[model samples]
Target: MIEYCLTVLGFVLAIVGRMDNLRGFVVLPKRWIVERFFAHLMRSRRLVRDFERSTTSAEAMIYWSMTMLMTRRLARQPPRRG
Candidate 1:
């Protein structure tokens, strides 16, 4: 029983070591990403604001647009198999 426990603990530690490497590899550049995102937003700021205010309709259009955008994005992504 003691040897079985030791082997299982070592196996868990090995898997955890690889997880640490993956964590480092997955971290992205925060500053550059924020700057690029803001630049893109600024480019379309006027157009988006104008469209948002042009109609006196309810906010459903905005919500619908966001839902469709997210749905399309999710649909385009590949499925993850367990």
Candidate 2:
């Protein structure tokens, strides 16, 4: 059931092409998204500084930061209606 819903959504998004600009070229939504995510991550003082020496730890901090940010957003927003 979820697969069917996801397949349908893929078709719908393909038609919409939200990633495209007026010239039919792919816009840099990913770059914008990454930049925005980092902006939020920087709100954490630990992330703002290069305190983590290990790459694994840095990546973990990023994941932890994103989790906190998402949970906070989810808490603020009402649940979706079907």
Candidate 3:
């Protein structure tokens, strides 16, 4: 039991050590991601304002809107006959 716990602890530490270090000033990840999502939302008039009465519904709507946009985009591609 002791050996197993030590091995697992070491493995966890090794994985943590290899993770990316955010040391420099840069555009925060959430801001960029949310901005792109909002851009997609702007394309839909219904998403322009908060129509959903609840936060959960608002989030669900965002996911639904993005998925719809992605499906339309994928559908627009012409298939190769070859």
Best by TM-score: 2
What's the TM-score of every candidate structure?
Answer: 0.28, 0.54, 0.49
Count of residue pairs whose backbone atoms collide, per candidate: 0, 0, 0
lDDT of 3 by residue, 14-59 (tens): 1213225766656565567878877999887768887889999888
Q: Candidate 1's residue-wise lDDT over 1-74, tens digit each?
A: 55665787653221212335453445245555766654544444343464564454425555555566567778
Candidate ordering by lDDT (highest first)? 2, 3, 1
lDDT of 2 by residue, 1-82 (tens): 5566578765332222363435665547666776787799999889999999899999999899989998998889687899
TM-score of 3: 0.49
- What's the lDDT for residue 1 in model 2? 52
Q: What are the C-alpha RMSDs, in order, of all predicted structures?
A: 16.1, 10.2, 9.7
Name the runs in model 1 displaced over 4 angstroms. Answer: 1-58, 79-82
C-alpha lDDT of candidate 3 relative to the true structure:
0.74
* lDDT over C-alpha atoms for residue 73 of model 2: 89
Candidate 3 wrong stretches, greater than 4 Å = 1-34, 79-82
Is candidate 1 or 3 superior in lDDT?
A: 3
Off by over 4 Å in 2: 1-30, 77-82
- Name the weakest run of 10 consecutive residues (lDDT summed) in model 2: 12-21
TM-score of model 1 vs. true structure? 0.28
